[model samples]
Target chain A: MPSVKENTIVTTAAAVELRGLRKSYGEVVALANLDLSIEPGELIALLGPSGCGKTTALRTLAGFETTDEGKVLVDGDDITRLPANKRDMGMVFQAYSLFPNMTVLDNVSFGLRIRKANSAERTRRATELLELVGLPEHAARFPHQLSGGQQQRIALARALAIQPRVLLLDEPLSALDALVRVQLRDEIRRVQTELGITTLFVTHDQSEALSIADRVGVMYQGKLEQLAAPAELYSRPATAFVAEFVGTMNRLPGLMNGGTVTVAGRSLPVDGTAPASGSEVDVLVRPEAITLRPAEDGGGLIIATTFLGSVTRVRARLADGIEVSADLPSHQASALTAGTHVTLELDEQPVLVAAPLPR
Target chain B: MAQPVTARLGRGAAWAAFAAYFLVPMGASIYFTLFDRDNHFSATPYTGLFQASGFVPALQMSVEMGVLTVVVLLALLLPAMVTIQLSMPRLRPIVETLCTMPLVIPPIAFVAGIIALQTRLSDADPYGPLSQLVNNQLMQTGLPLLLVFSYVVLALPFAYRALDAGLRLLPLRTLVDAARGLGASWPTVLLRVIMPNLRTAILNAAILTLALVLGEFTLATLLGFTPFPVWIVTSGGDHAQQSTAASIVSLLVTWGGLLILSVFGDRRRTA
Candidate 1:
């Protein structure tokens, strides 16, 4: 594994910058003052649910979506007014827009052909790209002749053929089956790494964003809720939305006082500003963060258990019916049966707290 | 699972009915053209077709008119189509509505309107808008501009629909963005990426437009033009057999062009 230092050096040159970006269509605002800085050669995933504007943000960078306000700077040059065709950025669409009329080689070589590269060079480079994507054997086949995964790979190779300064992927894997999605995700990361191209990947899959991206930005309703490394995002999500979205979180209703939150008849230390004492708050704890043991006196009853290969996910309910989940090793899980009572140990570290829901 | 015999029989009866209705009329037309009342099959019409000198002039005029209609309409429509497509997305609905308006207005009414407008405009200025320099000289030469303009108006519905479908089916955003990003000017993108992708649609529309131009009647007649359709109609009373021969020849030519277009279009798409 490459060290974090190597990754940082490769990705920290400020490749693209978005400042106070805003876009609206009629009454619905798609992106609102989105500010982001992508480092050169970095692969950053913009993760969000549908309509969160992650795709919109990627399009804005690609110059497909015009920004109503704010400047988009690429390598310190403002390109906000630049037309999409002049942006010189490469993009792989979610639909894998490999030209159906062209063969895989022709599709991959389209950018070079458009730029008027010498025919020999175009063919040579296209062949290299097809090989890079592991589809050199399929070059003669038209787009319809290939599988969805193969088509997307060709799309990626085509985008890269231009040697674009920035690569934009808009939900590139969302259209693929699960197994192929994972396979292609890894392949994309490998290719991006090998080429050291600055890439902005948009996806709604948290696991994809975390596993493949050097950093993940969680977008919510056209605003970025948090942007951080995968571990930080999962372990220390910046907001309740981030915490719940990045991972499965069991939230407990609580009251905040100073740096502590009172939940389920127990007081726990928390970070960040707390509302006035007795004010409602939401305390989030990850399933893995909570430890469980068979309760001697039947305190916590197992309501549900899901075996997840190496680990077991236990959905338990307290006597008061507060549902909480715990992740235990497979061996530990095997010892516990349905209806088994368990004791809980919440991680000592503080969890994220947000304003409580109203009745 | 195999289809039931009853279903198969039902389908066979439907096909028989279809043959009786469609093939029967066509077969009768061919029979009438080939055989006389005595039921003797003679190649008289086919033999007479070669000696038919009426087709020479008519064929030349039809080809000239069709080519002129296509070149002029494409020169007018392509830019308009590109402009409408790449314009502000908000204005798309309005542009689309305007483009489709010609379809709703009947061709006869459209030609009438064009003639009336041309007369009104020409009367207001004897040189006919650009007539000042040349005066009545240009008008005397018989400009087919207005005639072709009417044809374009008639053809706009199919042309616009085809072009719109082409633009919609294309990965337009990526194409535009890729071009612009690469520092290609708007003109370059319009000429390069947009035009290449639109070849099939443009060809199909142009072929259909050519067919429309070749077969058009009311507009050419109203405008006092000697185009094929008007000639064919006027020739009908003088020689019914000659008119039938002309119609068959024109149909074959038109069908040939359509066949070529369909084959090429299919190949281009699948290639």
Candidate 2:
């Protein structure tokens, strides 16, 4: 049986840094003074909406785009002005970037051939990459003959064949369906971890970013709002945008006081910076942090229930005409049905609070 | 169940009609070429092509013009089209308009404009550099380069449609970026990556240009040149049987060549 290469070349990874990156197209700025630094062998996911400059940052680092003012450094060497062909980066696009005219083997070995590797060496390396990607018998098939997922795997193998300086993924999984997307993402993560290559993954899917990245950078309006560990980013967002964008956050009216906020007669410390005291704020609470129980005299009435595999979501309306949603274990939520009166209990986790909207 | 009998009959009728429309003229041409003056079967008209005056030279001239037109057209249009689609996308409509302008104006009008310009230039300065360049070098060459230029324009609508369809089937920007990121230079990317994928489309363009160049009569004749079509028409005055036979032979040759090429292209693609 063909197997993964016994000796995959292990090269030392480089630290990548982007400083004061600025880009604008006529009136609209695509990237502001954005700056980022990545440690060697680390994978950072840039997460944002479309046109939020995540892709622009990745492209600029790949030397595909010229920034108005910026410096791209790899291991402290400035490479901002290098052409894409000279950057030695490997990229997997959204999908369908495979050269349709080439067989899978030819596609994989193309980079090595460009570097003037000998024939046997190219074939052996290409075969190893194909084996690494778990499609050992597919070397002779053209790209169009493969399934979409298979095509992407071959594309991944092609990218890694050269052991490129850095790996850049530009929404590579967005073209796939949900099941294939998750599977390929896990495959990508495993391969990236095994290779110990520095990577920049740009995606609009928050779950994809949160599940696979060492750190996730949230961007908005051409700015990096925050870059933090996935857990920290989800639990304690630096901005309201980050809080709402990363995960589902239920907004409840609260009164801010010093470093704490009061919501529905209960008090909790703020997750990040709190607004000035004695002002109304929007308290962002995670669904998992809220507990619900049936009580006739409770202040909230159960309005609906939704089954989500092991977790069930319960929506309730308070006496003051505010609605809240909570996610709880399915066993615990069996009794929480529509028209049941429930008393809500908040966990001890600090809650993020956003400034109140203008009246 | 198999296809319905009525549906089969409808398909049969469609094929019969198509065959009749396509084969009637072919059969008639064969009949005309095979019969001699004594009403006996002979291959003289077909074999007599080699002996016919102006036949070989006109054929050679047309073939040369067709080959040059395909080369120059592809060289100019491929990079230009790719650039317009990739970086200068905002200029797409302008380029498309310029490429397809020949389709709007009559070929006669286009040739008239060319001839008028040459006339005006030659009249203004009989021995000037501009007149000499236009008259002697460009038009009066051993085989006129002007016909090749005109054929490229005449074939534009067809070549553009072919190439555009092929390009639409591709994720052009993504492929280019991926190839560049893999360390292929721009020329390497174009030749090895993009052009190879465009093989069938390019052949389609080349065939269209060849057909246009070989069959074009108005531009060559109006500009005072006698290419294949003009020779064919002029030969009809003295040698009508040979002229008709040559038409049939040329049609068969073109179709046979295209069939071979398509088969060859398909084998390469599958391999």
Q: What count of clashes does model 1 give?
A: 10
Q: Summarize candidate 1's per-residue lDDT along A163-231 as a digit string, tens digits.
A: 888988988898899999999999999889887889999999988999999999999978888999999
DockQ score for candidate 2: 0.79
User: What docking class should model 1 receive?
Assistant: acceptable
| DockQ, all candidates in order | 0.42, 0.79
State the lDDT at A234 in candidate 2: 92
Screening candidate 1 with a backbone cut-off below 3 angstroms (N, C-alpha, C), the clashing residue pairs are A84-B177, A85-B177, A85-B179, A85-B180, A85-B181, A86-B180, A86-B181, A87-B180, A87-B181, A88-B181
* Model 2 local distance difference test score: 0.89
Q: Pick the candidate with the highest TM-score.
A: 2
Give one clash count per candidate, in the order shown.
10, 0
lDDT of 1 by residue, B1-271 (tens): 9999999999999999999997787676667777767888776665676566555565566676677777777778777766666666767788678767877987678767766765655563655546433333323324466666566777877887888888888877666665565546777667766777788888877887888888888777776766677767787786565566567767877888788888987877777
- Scoring only the A-chain of each prediction against the true A-chain gives TM-scores of 0.94, 0.96
Q: Write the per-residue lDDT of candidate 2 for residues B1-271, one digit (tens) a residue.
A: 8999999999999999999998998998889889876889988888999889988888988899899999999998998889888899999888888888889999888998888877766664756776776666567534888778888889988898888788877788988998999999989988998899888888889888888888999998888787788888999988888898888888989999889888977887777
